[model samples]
Target: MDVPHPFDEAVATVKALAPAVRSESVPVDDCLGRILATEAVARIDVPPFDRAMMDGFALRVDGELEEGITFSVTGTLAAGDAPTGSPPAGSAVRIMTGAPMPADTNAVARFEWCEESTSSQHGTTAASASVRLLRSVRAGESVQPRGQDGGAGTVVLGHGVRLAGAHLSLLRTYGIAHLSVAKRPTCSIIVTGSELCRDTEALLAPGQIYGANDAYLSGALTTDGIAVTECSYVEDSRDAIRTALVKAVASSDFVILTGGVSAGDYDYVPRVIADLGGQIAVRRVLMRPGSPLVAATVEGAVVFALSGNPAAGFVQFETLVRPVLRQAMGWHDEPFPASGRLLHTVKQKPVRHTRILRGAARIEGGVVVVDTEMAQAAGQISSFASANCLVRLDEPHVEAGTVLPLRFLDGALSSR
Candidate 1:
């Protein structure tokens, strides 16, 4: 049967129910991937002084690099040491990379460009001898003046940018030890099934399987930069679902219940949600693998009920749950989703709902192409591991080489 909720509308509805995550001040070391809440202004100039860009001699020059000019080597300047004295036009100081250039010196020539008279060119001590310049350099050569990166009060980072390692390095360069960043939205996962077991080391009985939903959901949430506050499994009882959900809603920003949302007698998540005063935002999405998806909101938190099938839940979390969580976490939705060319023909029964298939996508020679594997079934969990995208094919017959719509899985979106 065709599902009632359209995919686009379902996404919009899910985002509408997402709670806004708050911001907090945290140490720069812990701010990786966190969205900045405010502009990060440079407190001081980067490098903070006229510095040497290479291990070379620092001296004054007027024009293009000229050869055969010689100077008396007075002293060596280490990276952290203060310059002993400035060299006049006829002399130079052997400077190390990152060391401050001596005053009145407008250029630094590496030891490669000159030869020491009697001293070996290798050592921390001064080269007390006359040096001959074998290479010529223009004025200001290899010299990085102060404030080349940014002066104080310059906006080194703007608000809403996700902090990466490079960003933290800059923050550290300016002595910014702390950062103001948005906190990840907190959520809870409630796995509802009687045949699931959490103990992996124990022997399993006939009807019991190792619990996959809770662990997978928790990992997915963490990878998306969301905080998983609770993850618990419940029996196939309405009361059990209700009790677990009530606590989850009160304790977190959202609740995700895996299983028990469909029309089967064992499915009680929908009824329990309504009994708990939660309004059902969506009952069924027009997308296969997760057509039985259900959404509701209560107690200032949205509740998502996914299918018992592992692949279904995986797809739903990637396409539906992740987009909402990303929005709530203060990130922008991808304006233009990447697409892939079909590498093989796909045949499925005709239906009104959109079909979501797991496919491996790759870009070769500037073209995006995708292909499905043998394990592309709703109950199959292995198919998703190799797949980087969910190909959205609305029609029954998809021919090879046909361009199909696709959405890169959470955290896997990349520009072609």
Candidate 2:
């Protein structure tokens, strides 16, 4: 029997399955790509006080002066050290970069612009400094005022923000050592087929072929950060399928099974899941090659049964499973296919959703061009190896200028 489209059912299932994972506090060093659970507020104002931007003398500028005027140097200040009290009127304080400007000192004159000399002032030994009236130093010139970058009680980062390298640096600037982040979800894969053999050298008999679904499923899941801890191969027997399902459901948050989902008598996945009190949410999809896709929840654990064919299983995972995984991991956006124009004409079934074969994407004449390859058979695995995207075919046939939805094989195009 024909089944509802898996894409439609996948959206409903994800909405129904509320986020079950909790949040945890982790060190900022390990929070890259993790979702923030709370807003990060600045504990103190950035550059808490007025400070000098360069090595100069802190003095109150009266009027433009010639070489005759002189001022006594009170004391010296360096970065990270306190200034020797405010400089008295008619005198200057020697200060370095990052040193706090003394109170009542309105401006700073760079060392290169002033001339140094020695003279006795008020019967005390002191060095006289004067500067030719090259330019006037205005108040607060070249000084970073207090709270210029950030102020206390200000929200620096908001909740649900994905931490990047720059965000981490800001967190360090605020002295944030630990941050609250959402926990990541876990997933498992199960491969089933009697004709499937691990070692290719172990020649297959008349009705046998090497299993490629396990490798494809495992690699895809791993790239998404989903842990595939359980990988088992079961024959077409009912008892073996039941055992694999029970074990996988117990240990994994989500169970992915390859093969044994079709309607044939030997296809035991549906029966085993039903016998274990699992409800089949979706039994089939409208898409070609992946028409036998199945989704069920076995004892509260999500289970996805895909076709034995590698291409079919891979496409099913990218379209239906990846988005659910991302949601379970607390990602805010739904992972969907990118939209691009077709480079060549392609045909499809009128009533069913089709995925046309495509190679890689290139930019030609400042436009994206998706190259099409030969028609790939449903069961062919080699065609998907180098394939990057599945040009969605909503209608039976499409022309070269058609604007179609393109789902990337990997998560690469989801960003576009």
Task: Give the number of the best model, judged by lDDT.
Answer: 1
lDDT of 2 by residue, 1-416 (tens): 64575556555764455346458899999988887888888877888878888787777655443444566777777888876577787787777888888887756777776666654565664544543324456667657888899988788898878788999999888777888887766677888999888788897888988887777777866765567868988888999999988988888888989998998979999889989999777887767668787788888788889888877787777767777776676665443457667778876656645454555555566665676665477767676656777766667777887776766665453222
CA deviation > 4 Å runs, candidate 2 = 51-79, 90-133, 199-208, 335-337, 354-359, 383-385, 408-416
- TM-score of each candidate structure, all chains considered together: 0.90, 0.82
Q: For residues 382-402, could you state the per-residue lDDT of candidate 1 as single tens digits?
A: 867777788888899989999
Task: Give the C-alpha lDDT of model 1.
Answer: 0.83
Predict model 2's lDDT versus the native: 0.74
- Clash totals for all candidate models: 4, 0
